[model samples]
Target: MTTHLSVRAPDRDVLSDPGYQAYLVLRVVFSVAPVVFGLDKFTGLLADWPSYLAPWINDLVPGTAQQAMYAVGVVEIVAGIVVAVAPRFGGLLVAAWLAGIIVNLLTIPDFYDVALRDAGLLAGAVALSRLAVRYRSVQRERGSVA
Candidate 1:
């Protein structure tokens, strides 16, 4: 009597996978963009950051519009760092931040265009979060995650 043994093929490299490649691109972009924008809030090279704040939001906060923007800059910087370290949660954080920005923009006159743009960004953040979930699962199976 002869016995045959079956051998399983090794899994494909995740780096070569297209979905993983997309996730990497999104991860890098999401991680860097917010940090850059957040820093710019202090420099004002991009735009007048204070001008973007809605009057209602400014009133609700305990400071002037510019002061509020300073706080916003801090939050954005932290969010960006979080994305670099843990994208699964960072993406949701960015999405929530964008949602707040959208609502604020909608309340301001002549800022509807900005609100629409933020909505698109919000969608991208959500996508990143979903992709991170899949990536985390793969990492867990590989014993790379604790």
Candidate 2:
């Protein structure tokens, strides 16, 4: 007697999968939003970016708050690029960055509502990280011969 083992094809289309779709949406949003916001830091078209900096944090860093914002803009641009190229790590990077922002906002009495919004963003970042982990493993498995 011979026994047959069945294996599913590795080339299955994942675009239709709900999880993959969610992952793609999140990846794109995370990739774009940060870069746009980062650019705005220099242009100040959105808001006075430096004014959002907590005084304590400003004192801790050298130079003025605006200078710090310039540095932040660079970091944000880099982070967005990372998310675009390698979301598996980028998601965590964004989450960590958001955590810092949350702490900074909490220090400012007038920005609690903004902090709350950032907290929501932090959660989304965390979710993206988790989803990235799942999809990354799936991709690796799909690339390998079964």
Q: Worst lDDT window (10 residues) for model 1?
A: 4-13
Error of 2 at 85 (Å): 1.2
For each candidate in turn, the TM-score is 0.87, 0.87
Question: Per-residue lDDT of 22-92 in model 2, one digit per residue for the tens?
Answer: 88888999999999999988999999999899999999999999999999999999999998888878989
Model 1, range 1-146, lDDT digits (tens) per residue?
Answer: 99965443324697777887888888898899999999988889999998999998888999788888888988999999988999989999999999999999999999999999999999988899999999888866765641
Q: Which stretches of candidate 2 lie over 4 Å from their true place?
A: 1-13, 144-146
Candidate 1 similarity to native, TM-score: 0.87
Show the colliding residue pairs in model 1: none
| Candidate 1 ranges beyond 4 A from true positions | 1-12, 143-146
